[model samples]
Target: MTNITFKNNPITLLGEQVTVGSVAPDFSVLANDLSVRTLADYEGKKKLISVVPSIDTGVCDQQTRKFNEEASKIENAVVLTISNDLPFAQSRWCAASGLDNVVTLSDHKDLSFGMNYGVVIEEMRLLARSVFVLNENNEVVYVEYVNEGTDHPNYDKAIEALKSI
Candidate 1:
């Protein structure tokens, strides 16, 4: 179990976590097309997993847009914005925001992505705001779990870490 606080109240989650230097857990997430996409789908490419509570919130939307913008300049890297939102909602948000570079994956079906990644907010039925960067082998090289639920992550550091890989 992992402990996180929301609105100054402690919350507990149930799951083993993916940490820095840990091999990323493979997950079957729903894609914009409603097709199942596993970690292997991004094989041979650098990956950035942007985990957010929900895409409907301001912070989550900002994180997704920031990553989408940065993704265009990173060669051989795929930025995946992950959340519990439905694929249709993800598609709409991406289209509305002109976020073409980032791939938004939905974890609404089984919630295994959140559970395995250790970002699920058990009490709220949401994901914790976090980011994980992985190499082609799916080994996590960088990780950031934003302590504050409403805060954005340090994108510059995350990008630099990815560049170092």
Candidate 2:
């Protein structure tokens, strides 16, 4: 488990921390079309996952937008922006923002992605801010569990880790 804070109040996170070199956990998240999407869908390509508490917030918006922009420059890699927000909201946000390069997935269905990745905030029922980089083989290459829910993860560091893959 990992610890995090929301507006400075400490909160407990549920699930195991994803360590680099370990096999990435497989979990289901809802795609914009309400289809179940899993880690296996991105097999054979590097994955950069951006976990956010809520897409409606300012910080989360910026984080997702940044990754969407960066996704175009990254070859053979996909950027996934995940949240506990409903699939409807996620779709609306992505359509409004024109974030085609990055994919937005929702864990609202069962919190599978959150529970499996150790980013779920038990009290808030939202995913904590974090970033994970996985290699083509589905091995975790980098992980940054942001200390604060409202704060952004180390984007540069996560991107740099992707370069090594």
Best by TM-score: 2
lDDT of each: 0.86, 0.88
Give me the candidate number with maximum lDDT. Answer: 2
Off by over 4 Å in 2: none
lDDT of 2: 0.88
Collision count for each candidate, in order: 0, 0
Pairs in clash, predicted candidate 1: none
lDDT of 1 at 64: 88
TM-score of 1: 0.94
lDDT for position 84 in model 1 = 90
Candidate 2: Cα lDDT at 15: 85
> Which clashing pairs does model 2 show?
none
